[model samples]
Structures are given as structure tokens and as C-alpha cells.
Target: MKNKPNQLKYLKYQKNRNKGFSCRRNFLIFGNYGLKSINSGFLNFKQIEAARKTLVHNLGKNNKILIRIFPDKVLTKKPLEVRMGKGKGAIHDWVAVIKPGIIIFEVKYKDYDIIKKAFFCASQKLSIKTEICYE
Candidate 1:
């Protein structure tokens, strides 16, 4: 599923400069195991979808997966070989401004080994480094 919001207060947003650790959503709340990010960056919808697909495919359909972050930030991109001074380009994609120590994905499962393996495969699809944390 796409992670974009249906409506927003404003369309475009400025580039994020805050790189500090996350104060909220740093701990597990919805599930027993979670995938926590170790670095700060932007997570696009495609990357999120890939990771989610991997998790679901590997973990089976019975397990429940909860995504903590949403790609609500709008990203603009100018067309290639275009001249400057045309305001901001058209909206391109949506992304989530991720901070260190923020949990990305949470899963409720019985087997620890299977959960670890699924998380490892999912982490490879993301741009940021991640570690599995458990409650």
C-alpha cells in the first residue's frame, strides 16, 4: 500500500535539517519485536513497500506487521536539462524523515529466529542501517 496521506495542511515541505535522535516512537508499543533505525535519512514509499513486502513474504500471512512511520513529507523534483528560476518543480514522491532510534516496523510473532531472519531480509531493502529490537 502507498504511504501517502489523503490530504495535508500544506502540499510541499522544506528540507529537514534536524538529525537528532527521535524522542517519540523510539520504543516498542504495538508488537513484541521491532526494526529500529540506527541512522537519520529519508525513507521513500517504494523502499518502505519493498521492506514490507519482504517482511510479509518471509513471515507468512498470519503474522501482524505494524508500520510506525508514514511518508507524509512531499518531495519535489525538477525535470532533467531544465533551466533554473522556475520556482519549485512538480511534486515527485513522498518520504518520511527518519531519525536515529526510531522504530520502523513492528511484528508480533512466536519464533525469534524466524522474526530475525525476516527482519534481516527486510533491512537490505532500506537505505538506512537497522537492528532488531525485542520487548
Candidate 2:
């Protein structure tokens, strides 16, 4: 058996060699984060409205955001299963495209919540700084 340090080195080498840019860590984190949103019931109309209000209050009255709420499958254009191999799979949640650079997301919900989740997720991921009003 290899020593602990040797094992760690071998693992790192394997990750860098094979996985390289095709890593699923980000998607995994996204999935878990999404589960938290679901368990906590964060995907609700009121929460969405609050998010919208927050964006409007902060971004001002002129900023307009295009929001699209759909299944993670639709969002990623891939399967929603993380273990599907190779493919990053769909976002499995909401998808918000803020133009330029930003993709807000949520991994659950199949209704209006998707729209809201996408906007919020994109804003957070992109660090938009300003508010994302979806009105």
C-alpha cells in the first residue's frame, strides 16, 4: 500500500491528467447547492418577488433582466443526471442569461420559480454588483 502523501499525490496527478477541463466538481457543487435551495423551500413566489424587489431597489428603474425558468435539462441542454458521465448534464434548475456574461441557476422547481432562481443564481455567480430587476 502507498503512503498517505503518495496516495494524495497520485490522486492529484490523475485528476490533472484525465479530468483536466472536463471536471464535474462545479456541477456537483451546483447540484448540492440546489438541493439546499429545495430543502429550504427557497424556490417560492414570495421569495422570487422579494428577489425581484431587491434587484429593482438596488439596480434602479432602468435595468431590465431577461429571466427564463426551466428544468435543469433544458437549461444545460443535457441530461439532468450528474452521474451520466462525460456530459456536465443540464443545470437541473433555473437558468438566467444576463447577457455579456452570467448564468443564474436553480436545480429544482419547474414553474415561475425557475425564472426567479435563474435570475438570482446568475446575479450571484456573475457578481453583478448591481440589482437584477425582472419586471
Q: Write the per-residue lDDT of candidate 1 for residues 2-112, one digit (tens) a residue.
A: 668999998988885957899999999989999999999989999999999999999998789999999999889999999999798899989998999999999999899
Candidate 2 Cα errors over 4 Å, as ranges: 1-42, 70-102, 105-135
lDDT tens digits by residue: candidate 2, 4-84 = 222222221211111122122123222212211111111323334445455455444554432232211112345444465
* Root-mean-square deviation of Cα positions for candidate 1 versus the true structure, in angstroms: 1.1
- Estimate the lDDT of model 2: 0.31
Off by over 4 Å in 1: none
Clashes of each: 0, 7
Q: After superposition, how far is residue 127 of candidate 1 from its true place, in Å?
A: 0.7
Candidate 1: residue pairs that collide? none
Question: Which window of 10 residues has the lowest lDDT sum in candidate 1?
Answer: 11-20
